[model samples]
Target: MLIGHAIFSYFPIIKGWELLVAQFNRIDPEFFWMLAAGFLAQLVDGALGMGYGVISTTILLSTGLNPAAISGSIHTAEMFSSGASGFSHYRFGNVNKKLFRTLLIPGVIGAITGAALLFYLGEKNAGWVRPALSVYTMLLGIRILVNAFRKKTASRKVKNAGWLAGAGGFLDSFGGGGWGPLVTSTLISKGRTPRFVIGTVSLTEFFVTLGSALTFFILLGVSHIETIAGLIIGGVIAAPLAARMAGKLKTRSMMIGVGALVIISSLRALVKFAASFF
Candidate 1:
């Protein structure tokens, strides 16, 4: 009580604290909504090894945040969530060390490059770039759905894993989300073990997310602090549970769900963009 009184004696500090509290209170609904979205996205991401960014981006886009801001915010929050998820995946022995190594450097490079491009495109010409990204993500979603039905799996030895990882990382940054949809799906379709692939992807995502987030920070600064906070908190809360659940799930079902989610999100963006024209 004495300490509290002493602190309160500084009127400026007290007022600032009060103002911060008030601002937070005003955004409580939005914060909790973001939190719930983050929780679900991470749960799915952890279980199936993808979709957190895409799901989160869809939610933010629907709220009218610009593409750059949305990507930046999602990447920023993912830095924390991915780290947590990766650790959980590692603990569960879901990671493939070799694959993880092969994917890491290229993925980081791709993510950083893509982040720069996204910011550049956003600044120079945001009008069409966002829609194009939306379309691309939609296509990826379709591909994931197709993979779900294809029974023929390739040899586990992949010559293009690095390239595929690079592509996935690039798209993930450019489209605000695509890493899992592209890389994980491709690897699994090529005969990689679903549990191991999911775990490895989740683990690799930590570095990829960090690079993208840092790039976003350097280019765009911090735009959605509250959203990031919410996502990080909710994602961390769900990470362990999702990691445990990943091994139990069937691959086909996870693919179908991811595909459906991607389609819905991308379609929403496209529709909204089209509506703006008419």
Candidate 2:
């Protein structure tokens, strides 16, 4: 529990030596669970290019963690995880540099705006944010499922970069997940090449996540150090492997996997919320 309290404090700012010491100095059972969550989430996200946020956030929410804090912790840790994923995608020739640049700036802007909104909204009414996010995630999941059955066509260049990336970033920041679900699903459904879309989106996530996390830290202040650290450690371990697997996966399979996960987790969360009203 105390470890949970120490999970997400300015980790990137900490000296490498300090981080190394903290890892060894604070050995707690709870921290290991956090690490495991991170590892599993990152592995899924890496392989499928989505899931870190939905999976991790779902678990934390079920455990009764604060919604804002969970989002904060996820974005903070994602700063590192997305970076690793992006690097792997880049190395594997998955990214389209031109498309990456087009999406990056808008995504960052939307993420920052969304983070600020979430912080303010959550402070005023935390209850609203969690359930709302759960519903939104569920809807996105359903969209993916519909997309999975759609016929593939010849790859075409993506248009409306501003709208798509901005919306994805906003949804991602506000809901604490959705970059892949919203962006990847939509683009792939529109006939964008899966390999490039996954790679570009994965890489752009680093920026979107970084901006959102920074906004959260600025407004909400740092929190959940143990949880964040555990997630970061686990994600780091899994990211490279996930990146390697991304190119190998079929796009339809990836959509099905992501959609199923999102639907299940979101349904569970929503059901819990509905029960709370009863």
Candidate 3:
């Protein structure tokens, strides 16, 4: 009798649940596509420590959304995904505390500055920035690939890591994604362990992305709630798997994968930018 009474007492809550289901049903089919993109992007990012934002932004751009909306939505969704990825990496002992600490504040500051600039200045100058960054990342990718064929050596302490993180954060916020390729590639190229570099960078990304997302929210407000929700769900689901892959993969294999992904993504960006002129 008590159990029956408890169930009946929650009838209003059940009615609210039904309402929520109705709202979900009304969402556009695009949510499913975003979910797939988020899953694939997060999987790659978790394993190799880059590509989430780039992949998500590229797909979003194809839908013809404005840059502000794309950036805002991607950053918002990234907060959730990065949080999950960071936690998973920590659990796997992949994070480097010193690197995370060094990268945190500077990255946040740069991200905020970048978001503000993008809002005020728009993407008028993106043409120059995009190709330049693409070329830089492509070169970094080549360097990493070359390193993979060389004998292993002791990891070196990265020089000017703070400046690197700051620049990475700025580009990530302004261009809608570059943090992973810029930060992760540079660190790995400097002889840091690929796993730790990926892990620390992924963890730092949560805070950096949070700064950008908050700034975007203040300036643009949240427009694509369904897309964000889909990405969050997909990314969260893939986080653990990706983290495990990063931890278990061989150093050489991981470096090769990271190098290839960075090169391909950069080349794609360069090609896309060039095609715009014709």
Candidate 4:
């Protein structure tokens, strides 16, 4: 995580890596703006070991991309980002194939269904998600605080791993959030240590997201070719450094930071929802 943060902190000052200044010329004339979002997201993930997409997607959607499009596109972009991270963790033997396998079926199924639902949120009574998000945020904050104080443990019981992973993948695909920490937390609660859980969660998310991301392209025909390419390059170049840093990271400290962001994001989303009632 130290290296990851260094890479992140350096991106702004580096030249010849002008992803920061690039913008979508048409509707998003500032492509670099989105990359900046990606940069921050990755930094948070590096430092906190979670929440890259939640941060980036929220920022991206603020630019007016359809929420479904943001969900699909970010997942698509992060595929490469995730792919590498997953590979590294897999190499470390953190992944549980038997557990991850069960998730494949329901994950794909639920993702497709979720994406379909997201496509129409603008047309439906979307007002509901706000309060829901607020509640989710409030709860996430509480969860973090409690967990921070409690005796920490992760589950080693692979028995329910499949069900949990699939469910996490499904919810993450649909909401475009929660997959990483969700899986990590559940596995940890069951018996896995934070180290193995992080590795497993990061690694497995690659395949789960990759499959669903492809489906998004097939179904929605959306593309962010250049942006996705940029993220891949940036993410790849930074991985080795991130891997080394993550090893030295203090887990409890990292979770508290991320938990704070999640609560803030959730509250912001919910507050927007509440304001709309007026």
Candidate 5:
């Protein structure tokens, strides 16, 4: 009772609490939906090293927001979520320093370039770009699934890994998300170790997302604060757990999960693109 009186003496604590509750009550129901989306997306992304942006973007599109606004909000939230995921992966000993170094600069540059193009062009080019990227990613997913069933072969070096990272970063920023499906799938198909590839890619994603988010903030001025906040909170909460799962899953199981997620996301994108025609 004395503690409560002391707290009350210091401020209008009850009034402030009431106001906060009122603010929360007034928040759009979409915030709660986005919160759930963020948790699921980050869980998949952390474990498989992809899908957060794709999942979040798909949900946002249903809200009738334009491509630029969706991308802006997703990337802005990704800055925090990916940072947390990267640290969590690092803690789990999943990050490959060499691969991370290879992907970092090129990924950042490509992300900035893509974000700039998306800002300048808006959604005018999304029709063709989305379909093309979706088809390509779907093919990659199929390849990954097939590889999961094949006999183990000698791992081959990924030629022009920098170029692949650049392409991934570009598409992820431009199309809302494809980095994991493109870079991770390509690397795994090349016979790279799944654990290291996923971890390194997850680490690199933070920088790529940082570049894209900054670009969006500059061009778009950070609209959708509540949506971004919801995603960040949910993703952050799930990051450590997802990273632990990444470390524990078998290589084949991880590959299968990654392949399925990529295929599903790509198919969804294609369907949405097709629907736009009507």
Candidate 6:
């Protein structure tokens, strides 16, 4: 099932990875390449609700694209990925409109501000945000993992959890992949109902990513249309299926697995960032 999602949503990303491999015989790239990376990242993102921005932006930046461009494109691609998931949640009546409305404005503001900064960083060779992302995601992953092993667990979706959502959006825009896991986990933690938390998180992902994508295209043009189209197709095909599967998943186990995977990924990223300096 996980492999299915990976294959479905991440086909484009895998394609991009192969290209990088072809060029260098591995995953390493000399610069940013949006088409393959962004598309594939979103595929996995749609399937898993995380890793889209982080992996795509990281790989894209390797392909020689400026930080700004990679950031823009990653943000842009997320719109489609998040939209599909968000719509599904809304359809299922999982969305808490009252809480969502309260959170939307702040979420949007934080995203816009972060996106503006992301563009600037995308143009440079800095890895400043990467480590921060790595650390935060790693910690969240650990926390969830701990929660998963607990015998008596309390998972409630709270109405007053907007601050975490807003903060997660801002950090995700800056650090990457913080949106879904971070916010979803926080909601799960603060005694929010599971159904509403999942729904609210998914819907918020749609809006947050949709807004970011718009900013990217409007501000920075997409040079590779075909690649972008491929990503579009992949996302369209993967989102609904993933949502269906997500609905069937036992939330607790899924959270633990997701948390574990993210932690592994974040550790890898953190190590890489540390290595860069040496």
Q: State the C-alpha lDDT per candidate.
A: 0.82, 0.79, 0.91, 0.61, 0.87, 0.65
Task: State the number of backbone clashes in model 4.
Answer: 23
Q: Which model, 2 or 5, shows the larger TM-score?
A: 5
Tens-digit lDDT track of model 2 for 1-278: 56654664534435756889887777877688888899999888877667788788867776678777788888999899889889998998889899888889989998998888876775444345557767766776787778777785555666898788898898788766667766776676566666777888899999999998888888888788988999999999998888887788887887777678777867876787789878
Worst 10 residues of 5 by lDDT: 121-130
| lDDT for each residue of candidate 6 in 1-278, tens digit (9 for 90 to 100) | 88978885867777878777786654223222444554456555544567666676666655566565555556665677678767876775667898788667777766766666666765332357667767877887787777767775674545556676677777667655577667765665554554566667677787777666666666676764443554455555666665665566676766665677678788988887789779
State the number of backbone clashes in model 5: 0
lDDT of 4 at 99: 58
What candidate 1 gets wrong by more than 4 Å, as runs, is 1-27, 123-154, 258-278
In the range 15-71, model 1's lDDT, one tens digit per residue, is 888999998778768889889988998998998877797678768877788766777
What TM value does model 3 have?
Answer: 0.90
Q: What TM-score goes with each of the models?
A: 0.78, 0.79, 0.90, 0.72, 0.91, 0.74
Better of 5 and 6 by lDDT: 5
After superposition, which runs of candidate 4 have C-alpha atoms over 4 Å from their true positions?
1-29, 46-49, 92-105, 116-141, 151-160, 189-191
User: Candidate 5 clashing pairs?
Assistant: none
Better of 3 and 4 by TM-score: 3
Per-residue lDDT tens digits of candidate 3, residues 1-278? 89877986877678979989999899798998899889998999999999998889888888888877777888999999999999999999999999999999989998998889888988776446778888999999999999998997467888999999999999988876779999999999999999999999999999999999999899888997988998899999999999999999999999999999999999998888889889
Which residue runs does candidate 6 get wrong by more than 4 Å? 1-44, 58-66, 120-126, 156-160, 191-195
Looking at model 4, report the run of 10 residues with the lowest lDDT sum: 21-30
Better of 1 and 4 by TM-score: 1
| Highest-scoring model, TM-score | 5
Residue 62 accuracy (lDDT) in model 4: 74
Better of 1 and 2 by TM-score: 2
**What C-alpha lDDT, on a 0 to 100 scale, does residue 213 get in candidate 1?**
88
